[model samples]
Target: MTRIRLAPDDGKAINLNWRDRFVATDILRDAYVRYEESLNPSAPPFVTLDDGLELGIVHSDVPAIARAISSMLTCSLEDAKNENGGHLPSAVVERVQLEIISPWGVANLWGQTGHRFVLSRSGGGGRSEILATILVGQSRQTIFFLTGRYNNLRHSTVEEEVDFDQPAGDDPDQRWFDLFAFPEIERFKPWGYHHIANFVVAKGHRGERLSRRLLEGIIERYAKDHLDANERPIEHGQHLLCGRGFWQIGDPPWLTRMERLGFYLRWGAESFFIEKPWAPLPAVFDGDRKIGNLEYNRSFGLPERYQGPRPTVASDEHLLERLPEVIALSEDPNAKLQYFQTMFDFC
Candidate 1:
């Protein structure tokens, strides 16, 4: 067994763990929901698919004796009767306990680390709270899963090699990772970048800079795992912090801090952008030379490729005008199913 040591046991150590499972029940499920809402009040009011994730307990292994007995019961009615005739024989079973809770199940963090990250606090009773989290992974599979559409899975890839250990030739969708690619960027090759988002800051802890600390923890963890211990001054490749620009603040202006630390803008799409090598951009591109970038902080803008009608009402007048038809469709089960995924029309 290899026992590795971590350097700098300070307040900055990342709390990475391998499949840490806490005893789960109905109570914990509700508590988790409360935990999420307390951080982001904008989350859905009730349990929808977006909020309907839960830990599933599965018996990963059954002892050979148990399997033998089960086979006997299946094959011989007489043997089954011997075990059940007003006296069902029960025996202690040995098995491996595996919990099926991933980020999606435990906290609605759709694409979370397969390995859990647990913190060791000062007091014995640690706080069971998740103030903020960032889900980092690779490629189009991340976006494909988030869109909740299965048919379009094949069309989502931007790069070929994902950062997963899945065997070659397996279904990429089932692998839970994506690769990085930017067609607009200069002859961009398949890059080993991870997507970092689903970041949330608890309502009360809003200004505490927990987000920044969490990001640092992530970098620490990443570096530690990729350490070339045999080689001095371990080197790593530059990557992307994939973020959407549709939010009110858009692409966390705090990212500018990372730019100062050697990160810079690598690509800018209509509603998304990426940073590479730690650099800054006073203004992001508008996908044109003559039109050029409109200057920094265009958080209010939508995708340039979006051809959807503009809002008629100040708040959403254009969309509101189409509500009656959407409502009518909602009245019929078939129509509702057909149009349910069309969020723009309903909104």
Candidate 2:
């Protein structure tokens, strides 16, 4: 099988880590599995270029993590820091799969979306750099603008709901939640509305035009040409879809410049995971009576036990509250690829 190749000066060689790689791999694998499950007919197992290359997340406790973050977001950072004992939130520490890469043998996987990106090393003794980043893709929805309800196609069960006020799910079946927005459009604006995800770029490589191309490539490849859960495009006969582009708060870093590239500021709730919460669960029916807290799992494939549970994003109000903190932390930036590979067990 053809694999992605890295340059001698490729960032992976300069700053690869095992722990982060494991996290990235886990996410990649999960994404592939979920993607395959969405097929009309179950597709074959999803793998990257080669069979030996594996992907996944490392932490065992994912649901609990969302809960921790949710709690932190609702309260002050003092509360957040105090509860977590001054360490990075367990969710961010154990589960967050920032990104990672390996020798693909033939091709290269690069990006900023914590999925793919470019890496470079300054000649001489200068620092290595991640030239550009782009969070590749997301599933879109055509939902009621006010209600935030999705137009369900493939996963009709998830499509029917319009709940935005409550946490996503505490039970098995309803593992994740979705958000919606109606982006504003004006004469000065390049495009009125588009859904956005967060992104970060390596220093020095930030402003180059080619970097813009890389970001555009990732978005176009993943966002366009894909249909909603209902298998319909967001707009008729057009690939235009909805999403949010993130900007770091304070000091207006690289992401701020993206505004000229067709992105806008939008608001939403921060996503959260409630571990073993007493919170009521989604309703299920057993002929006549309503049942609560069902164990949700799919049969006929890899061990369900191997899969990590999904987490729900925060509501607009919650997200709006903690938005500044999110950007504040994003600005400080975390260790580069080399920092991770040297410290963790990714492979």
Candidate 3:
């Protein structure tokens, strides 16, 4: 990963005011431009960092920049306080960071249509820096492709038939279904539903009701009608039906965190553990590690129960029940599903 550290001298001359901290936008933009140019000199120079702040790149960049931005905001806020004779209040500093990184900020940057990144603000009108974000968008076809009910051939040159093949030997989807005893998965269709992925929070900001604020923000935003990219009214928009992620098996703290956010273990557990698996584990859980008695044993030497971490598919039943109404009101439901599948298809 590339890290961009702005030089202290660069910001020393700039007079920062609490009321006009946006003047630093150009400085932050310049830092990002220099960072990108250092990695790719032959490419055209970045015209503006605003373009990079769009939803597509921002989702991926959030984790990469979270620490950097947090540091930058802290420095800028401290500088403002020093310049103003230490009169800046903690609430003011928190409010500034909150405004800059809040969901409203993302919506303003990406526009209100056709983007998936959702951010959250602190509850009770309290000010705090954005602690987490989640990506939510239509993903019916992704489910279909994963289940082998459909083939995502958007990038392929040749025609192909529906992929009815059974899940591969090490396929996590199959393991997920087996864990939950969800035998009726084949009959499931995720129309009028959004899939959440890349749920991220700054390491320094965890344990601060991150999931509650983020999920609340998502529900609050999607509960209302919104205009699509083509200016069509979308009623009851942005419902989250499912998510695919991985976690260490028997990790109660992690499970509790997810459940509090309305995500239950729909698919994943020790009963379906795989050994000598072809599929790779996520980087966070790809080693011989221990959490109490349960070791994340990555090889075949350990007992089958501790052989490897599990792939998880989590869902909120409350959200699942609401999908029918969303699908009913959704215009050209088939076309919408196709468009989402095509847009997200990378296979």
lDDT of 2 by residue, 272-328 (tens): 212223433233233344422212111111122123332132223122443443333
Query: Total clashing residue pairs per candidate?
Result: 14, 50, 0
Lowest summed-lDDT stretch of 10 residues in model 2? 337-346
RMSD of 1: 22.7
lDDT of 3 by residue, 224-318 (tens): 22222224322221232222221112222234455555554433121222222343222222223312112322221123312244424333322
Model 3 global lDDT (CA atoms, 0 to 1): 0.31
- Cα distance off (Å), candidate 1, residue 174: 30
| Per-residue lDDT of model 1, residues 1-347, tens digit only | 12122122211111122212222222222222112313234542222111222111111111211121122212222221213331111120000001111211222122233112211111113322333333344332333222111211222353332334352235544332122111221212113233333334433445665555554444432333332322322121222123221111113333444344333333222122222223221222233321112222223221221235433323211233333433333232222110011001101
Q: What TM-score should be assigned to candidate 1?
A: 0.30
> Against the hidden reference, what TM-scores do the models get?
0.30, 0.27, 0.33
- Global Cα lDDT for candidate 1: 0.25
lDDT of 2 at 136: 23
Off by over 4 Å in 3: 1-115, 118-130, 139-192, 224-253, 267-273, 276-347
Instruction: State in Å the error of residue 119, model 3.
Output: 2.9
* Candidate maximizing lDDT: 3
Best by TM-score: 3
Candidate 1 deviant stretches above 4 angstroms: 1-126, 138-190, 224-226, 229-263, 272-347
